[model samples]
Target: MSGNRAAIRYAKAILQEANEANAGDIVFDDMRSVQATIRGSKELRVMLKSPVIKAEDKRQALLSIFGDQSKYTHSLINVLVGNKRIDMLSGVTESYISLYNEAKGIKEAIVTTAVALSSELEVQVLEKVKEITGSTNVTLKNDVDASIIGGFILRVGDLQYNASIANKLGNIKREFSKSL
Candidate 1:
């Protein structure tokens, strides 16, 4: 919980600072790159969590990877490293994205299905979701999950509509047990 709070705090601070400097959009892109890099690299994740490594070394490594970032992002890195909170950088980036999306009135959604969605189905899902949510700026992301067996689950913010086959099976199983 403390980690989440810290990430939110950092995100809010960065959002405010970047907006004041008229670089909110640029920093948003930078945050996306930062999040993508950290999420895709197992080595970087391991290195960030390793306590034996010096903070300065980690800071240098991050700067090199994200050297194209604006001065605002560089300052953010310095602040995190100085406070020994570099491991929370990814969380901070994600939180900042959420905040940015909110500021822009954009809604983000994740749809998990048994198989990859066809482009047509993806458009249909987005239309249905936007209609249901009454949101004009909805962004839908598709995630394939074979474990769900069939159907799809849609999640928008904290609200989830679970129409997946796995959930239905669990409900049926519960009913059968109750009958027994």
Candidate 2:
């Protein structure tokens, strides 16, 4: 828990520096790519979490992978490596992406349903999300979960609407059990 908090703080600091440098967008893209790379590579993730490796070695390895990234990214890696907090790299990058989105007035909504959303449904969801959040710069992600049975679940930041059939059924069962 504390680690995540520290990661978030680091993320915010870097984001502020990126904005001050007038390279927020470029750094945002770099962080997105870094997040994608870390999430995609099992070996890299393992290596990052391993305490056996020297911080300098890990730093050099990351530098090689993200050679083309912006100066802020390079500095971030430097700070993490110097502080021996390289294990927090992924968490920090993810937090940074979230901060970047919030800074740009972009809200991410995650929709889960029994099946993939049709184009029309997706548009409708986006419209509903905009109405709820009052943010026009909304990004939607659709996740399919058959166990939800039907309907959809919508999440925007810390707010969630669990309108799934499974959830409704559970609520009904709970209400009936309580009446007994």
Candidate 3:
């Protein structure tokens, strides 16, 4: 199976276990911390993925890092090490985020503009998107593209609303060509 699928499966299992243990919130926080750790440390990732290291060594290392922090997290790390699936750590973290978002009913949106938007404009746009999507929680990622010249593009998951000058030009060009 793909790494993402495996990670998602592992995350689901971990979530189930956390619920059973009455430590769901703790597990979520631990997963977030682990994700941050993986993102911040390339050496740590290499060490975790190294076949030369024994599972016990990996577990000990995880324990040293997160042992006292949260028992559920420590146990989860040990389980990953025992399974020799450290390479999926990043994916697992992402999966956990997705699960968390689902639980919280949050949606992420990306908005790209030719220029930076004012704080008020940004808030207005976010509010509009939240209203349109009916999402209680919305996270926005902004991108600036000078080539766009003007207007903005809003992307909500697989759907995109493009109102950029570049797209307008392309549309006009297409229409002109068809008329030729």
Candidate 4:
């Protein structure tokens, strides 16, 4: 069907196979490596997506690349290739990552500041987030935006906490316009 749907199906298939083989962690690592390989090599991606390439040839290539590392992963790649779903490789890998994260209860947080945060500040922010979300674990990605002037913005999942000076100023400006 659709690329995303196919990708989700393949991801589930891979996860199920991994679980059955009692190598779920190993398969996850292998999937990460596979995703990196596809992202790093344009030629490899082209080969994987090429309609002219035979399924057997694709399977051989995938086996050569990942067999020693992870036989289960190799088989998963082969199945995708055989089904003419190689183009969904990236999406599949992403879906697998999402699934893995959900299984692990890992939360991703994005924190943006006008200036680079010191280690102490970072720790403080992380601790505050943990307290607020009651999340035992947090993956914090940091970004610096000079346009923000000062303060920070924290985004955890679908929720955003914007304390940036730019946002505050914009809000004040809106209030002034309304009053006028």
Q: Candidate 3, which segments miss by more than 4 Å at Cα?
A: 1-3, 109-129, 140-156, 159-180
- Which of candidates 1 and 2 is the stronger one according to TM-score? 1
Once superposed on the true structure, which residue ranges of model 2 sit more than 4 Å away at CA?
1-3, 112-124, 142-152, 164-180
Counting clashing residue pairs in each candidate, in order, gives 0, 0, 0, 0
Candidate 2 lDDT at 135 equals 83
lDDT of 4 by residue, 1-180 (tens): 113777888888888888888888898787778877888799988987888988788878878877666877767777787777767777888678666666778776779999889999888888988889999888665788899999999988779999999999999999999999
Error of 3 at 119 (Å): 9.1
lDDT of 2 by residue, 10-84 (tens): 999998998988999999999889988998799999999998988889999999999999989999999999998
TM-score of every prediction relative to native? 0.87, 0.78, 0.65, 0.64
**Where is model 3 poorest over a 10-residue stretch in terms of lDDT?**
67-76
Task: State the lDDT at 98 in candidate 4.
Answer: 63
- For model 2, which pairs clash? none
Highest-TM-score candidate = 1
Report residue 73 deviation for candidate 1 (angstroms): 1.6
- Sort the candidates on TM-score, descending order: 1, 2, 3, 4
Quote the lDDT for 155 in model 2. 87
What stretches of model 1 exceed 4 Å from their correct place? 1-3, 144-146
Best-performing candidate as measured by lDDT: 1
Per-residue lDDT of model 1, residues 1-180, tens digit only = 113989999999999999999999999999989988898899999988999999999999989988999998999999999999999999999899999998999998889999999999999999998998998799887888899999999999888999999999999999999999
**Cα-based RMSD of candidate 1:** 2.4
